[model samples]
Target chain A: MSAIERQFYHFAFDPASRVVRMALGEKKLDVTEIAVKYWAPTDELLKLNPSGLLPVLVENYEDGQTVVVCENRAILEHLEELPLSPRLWPVPMQERAEARRLVGWFERKFDYEVNALLLYEKMEKRLMGHGAPDINNLRAGRESLRDHLSYFESLLETRNWLAGRSMSYADFVCAAHLSVIDYFDEMNWQKYPHLKTWYMVIKSRPCFRPLLNDILPGVTAAAHYKELDF
Target chain B: MSAIERQFYHFAFDPASRVVRMALGEKKLDVTEIAVKYWAPTDELLKLNPSGLLPVLVENYEDGQTVVVCENRAILEHLEELPLSPRLWPVPMQERAEARRLVGWFERKFDYEVNALLLYEKMEKRLMGHGAPDINNLRAGRESLRDHLSYFESLLETRNWLAGRSMSYADFVCAAHLSVIDYFDEMNWQKYPHLKTWYMVIKSRPCFRPLLNDILPGVTAAAHYKELDF
Candidate 1:
């Protein structure tokens, strides 16, 4: 008998990679994490994924075969195919669609409307040696974030989870993006009580622990980031 | 027993919607197409998908149940769940990952690098009444397009399909994007022999006929756009 070894190439604070990390934890799949500076992706990373996008998952089966899955959409689908307990997608069709919709929301809509401005200005600029955050972009991004938070709060007011009763990939997608933003101390947690409560519960899950300790050099996470209850 | 009523809200030139159109065609599913302006979405469209993105699918089951799936990723996943004949995702794990990776490529990286500039300049600007296209942006976008085309050409030179042996969603995704670009007379088919051959074969499929006839007002397609062979 042989083991299925896995290696994950990802960057800390990358929302996409963060989702993958949480899924890996939930699935209890042991993998070696290889941290990479997303701005200056390595040759090996580019070889595995021509786009040099994070994160890329390379799974090595003992039979000398390797499978490389790149980015969030591909990686998540690949992971879901495994016969593991605690499904990331819900069992019911409608619920699964809801979960998938929210996941797409974070991937395309939220990332563009929020992270492209907020994360790029705050985190990516510094990492890419492009200097400090732009105040105008930061303001716009925060405004967008508030609008998004309110929307999420409304959903949470009605349902137990973002998608519905089940804790699915939608929750992780939200948590992943929000966690990265929270690290920059950009969120006004008090404004959305429902979202704040949801965050507290989501971040406390054992799968989220590793993410709390993830440190990007010279960048400090929010003061309350590590706390289980805040 | 009542029939399943499906309504697809989409814009003609939208690459994402085109993919969905082909999927519906391949599955031989009956659907009502309600064309909407992607730039200025209607109230009903916004109600179904708050993001106001193209290609929102509304399914009204015979049982009086309704399900709405928004955007490409969600819509594609929802469609795949049905007990349909043609499987979009390849059966083998590695091949499926390849198909998914290419789909994600078009969704994120390609959309940003090429469509954001090229389509926005050539097509979207005209639709939005944003005035003439910027020459500099067009140059940059064309350069990026050439690079991407070369990459795809190399892949096609070896594999029968974009994702290897099986004809999967990867082919649809590629054809969708390229068909849109080719409509604007941007693609130089003679340069990439393999890609041209592949495109001709793909576009000649029964499902692609409707897309070939799609016309945007005040914009002319390439001279050879609708031809089965070029």
Candidate 2:
């Protein structure tokens, strides 16, 4: 295991990349991080993952064998398979299903509904040299975000974590998406009290430390972005 | 295991639903099928999956225990966890990564690039009464599909399967997406002979039988859709 070296390629603001980074942080595994821009992906990044997606992990073994894992589900599952503590999936069949379901929910629904509108207008456009943000898209994305946040708040009203009592990857998954949104000051912290409290706790974790430290070029973080007590 | 029973809810034309159905078929798991229309989703369907996504599976145990799994990754992972033959993932680490990566590719890339354009204009608009197909969108989707097909054909030129030597779930994933596109006669089969041949071999499998028989209401399948020797 000592001979195995890891290299992770990702964009700092990419929600998908954040999930991998936070998961790796949770697993307490060290890796060499290679930052790439979403607008201008490097040739090496394309060679590794033809899809040109972020957060690709490479595991290099002593025998010259290399495994290039791409996509969130594949990379996360591959990491979970390692002999590591803190199992991501819960014990109960239903909870595990719930966690994965929520993970899919954010990836499928939230990404389309919120990120495509909100994050794209706020973050990606800035990074890509695209002109000023579209007010209509920003408004539409915010409207959709409220609905999604209310749904999560409903779940948090009963359960301690996103999935259930125990903390699962689903929480990290939710935080990764919301944190990037929150970075742009989109979240109305006063409305969702329960989610606000939950966010503060999860946001204060050691794994989340790296995320707060990350500085996105050309974009200024929100006033409370780096604060644990926010 | 005789004390256990299974039920599946799906929409016939849904690519995500077909992936689950095909995987279940390959596992030889008998499930009671419940057809639900996409436009008018039943209350029970929304209750099972809040997202109102198709292909939710429920397993009932003799002890009055029931497990509901929703979404493709969660449901498929749950099914693979069962003690079944014909593993979906290959043994080699790299092959396993490749298989999962391709699955994500179809879900994220193909769904956005092709299905949202081609399938939406062709099948969904008719089902939803959203008017006639848009020729511009169809042309754009076909152009994108050709690019994707060339990539697949390049892979098929070397490897026996989509992921690698073993006929893992990656083949089923690609088949599921392509099957839906082919249903609308969107696929230009002649351009990619290797992919066409690969599709022929997979399309002949017994697991693919139900897909062939499935008829989406108000939409006639392409003439060659059910032909095994096409």
Candidate 3:
């Protein structure tokens, strides 16, 4: 059988892709990164993902057929099953459920509020010429982000990681979304001290280097983007 | 050991809870259903779930402590692990990932477009004392629902069930949301023949009977709600 080819198709600046990229880096998987222009939705990418979303990992297993895994949470779950990575999910069923819940929370709630707001309001307008930025929507999003950050602050008060004591997929998912908003200087780090501390630990990890180096054409990282202590 | 005690706190009219209730029924687990007043936004429920979301399952898993499983998808995953129920998730990693993706798509995308729009425009105004319903948002939501229904029709074109050949958690999730909209006579069954057929099969299942019997005090089921053929 020919060697299996693993490829991930995503925009470099995408928050979802950053999470998957971090997971792949942690796994030390040699996968080719195919840059997708998310602004201009391509039929090929849409064919791979019916939702026309990003962070799709095409895994060429030994059987020659490629398995297309879309959705950041789904892709992370798929990667967790492989032996290459140190187990990112907890073994206990209850603990694993908690971890998965947080991952979904980040993807569905936080990403929808923060990343969608920042990207659509700030980035997409420049990238795609979609429309004038809606300040009201952005304000609502920022308020939602503060509410979410407060919730995370409370969670981090007791547990070391977002889900629990150990670093799991939840941390990466949260970090990925937050990093994108951080690029736009959207999050107020001081308001969420515990979240800030937890984020600092994850952000300082070796696997996070690729994400820190990510620079979009028009967007610049926050002043404290590379700082270990903000 | 005392019998495992499970309590599910949610509004009977909520689609997310309906899915969890069906899953619980399938497992033959007795859970005391506590109806949450969605309009009031009680502190007790919010304390249990900081997100203030419905369908929070508190499981007393034979151990002294109880596990709070939030998120409809996570609750379904927890139920799938219990020894009582037949497997809803496939054993293979790839199949499981596929099931998870479909569940996410339905709960997030389809629910946002179809259920949320229908509920907010038609039902929530009556419940929340919100201002006159926004016609434009409703129109956009209906258009999006048509696109979403077509996707489901296409899925049913090939497979017996939403996720695949077998009835999985995805079916319960979709059926739960659809049943809620069906309550309001929002779904035009004739428009998508394939989806209607699929819905009928799911609606007929014994686990779905409780949902059918559920009657919100002030709200009435659509004229065709009880008609199996409709």
Candidate 4:
């Protein structure tokens, strides 16, 4: 069979984009990655995904069929359906549901409470030249992050992975969100030891390596952002 | 085999809850519905779902095991997995991905741009006794809803259903969101003929019967809310 051509449209600091990126990496799929400026998305990007969301995957199969998938969860599920080895989803139905649940938790609730606030304030507005970050929003986001991180710490104390025993999409989704936040150097890993350790394990994964190298203009990641042993 | 007892915790006007409710009806599953006051979620609600979001589905299976599933997508998938008739998802993998993509689109994008704004300003604040509606937010939500409705109209013009041939979760999710907005008598259906017709078809379904009867306290639905020909 002839090789399929794949293209991934994404943004650097976007946690959702990172989720698709890590999932692709886990599947060992070689594809071209193009970064989009989310603030001023190009017409081409808008045409590709009318939603104007990041992490759009375009696949051209050998059978002359082309498919374009948007939305992070949709892309992740699509990749999981492929006959590739080292499946990112767990085996059992219940465990798989738990993995999807945690993925949804990080993608929706945590994002609404934390990531959206920080990214809009610290990242998007700056890119769009809106204004300086709002102190109130940043404060609220930071507070929520602490609470979520503490919960993650508790989860890690009992389980080897976030969803269960295996390193499923849940782990990748959480790590992707945390890594983006870590780019702002706001995470106080000292307070949450178990969560920190769990993050360290994910950070060391080969699939997560490319994300560490992502550098946005004029922004520096945390001191230990790229270090696995930190 | 003994019958499986199921309880669904939901809010009357929550779109996500409506999605699950409609899915349950389509599958012909009998489940007890419990209304949740989202503004002041009880401790038991928190324990069932720490995210404090609904609708939460608690299943008492024939095996005498109890399971609690939260998040609309998770609950819908769980119900779909059961050995029941009338599948909500399509059979082919590609079609299924498209179904999920549209479901995610309605849940995230539509929710963010339209439902979140309108509900928070008009519904949630009043329910929580927080304050009156914000004109700016309501205006923004109306504008976004128009744009989204136009898109839906275009989709319905080409396809038999939102996602594909047979009615799927996408139709239920979009219909659910629209039903919530329609509760306020805000939709201008005459402008988008195709979308209105599509909604009318869904409204006439036996699965959509329960949703039509939903009446929020002190909020009178539009005159045509429960009318099949509306």
Poorest lDDT segment (10 consecutive residues) of candidate 3 chain A: A77-86
User: Comparing only chain A of model 3 with the true chain A, what is the TM-score?
Assistant: 0.91
Fnat for each model: 0.62, 0.86, 0.34, 0.42
Candidate 1 structure quality by residue, lDDT tens digits, B1-230: 32389899998899999999999898888899999998899999988888888898888888887888888888887788788878999997888988998999898778999999999999999999899999999999999999999999999999999999988999999999999999999999999999999998898889999999999888889999999899
Estimate TM-scores for all models: 0.97, 0.96, 0.90, 0.94
List each model's interface RMSD. Answer: 1.0, 0.9, 2.2, 2.0
| Residue A227, model 3: Cα distance from true site in angstroms | 3.9
Q: Using TM-score as the measure, which candidate wins?
A: 1
Please give the range of 10 consecutive residues that has the lowest summed lDDT in model 4 chain A. Answer: A91-100
Q: List runs of model 3 lying over 4 Å from the truth.
A: A1-3, A92-94, A130-144, A187-193, B1-3, B92-94, B131-139
Judging by DockQ, tell me the better candidate of 2 and 3. 2
Q: What is the DockQ of each candidate?
A: 0.74, 0.84, 0.41, 0.52
Candidate 3 residues A4-111, lDDT tens each? 888889887787888889898888887898898876758988887777778788877787666778778678767876766578987666577778778777766676
Over 4 Å off, model 1: A1-3, B1-3
**Evaluation by TM-score, superior candidate among 2 and 4:** 2
Q: Report model 1's TM-score to 2 decimal places.
A: 0.97
Give all candidates' CA lDDT scores.
Answer: 0.90, 0.90, 0.79, 0.85
The CAPRI classification for model 2 reads as high
- In model 2, how large is the Cα lDDT of residue A202? 92
Question: Residue A96's C-alpha lDDT in candidate 2?
Answer: 88
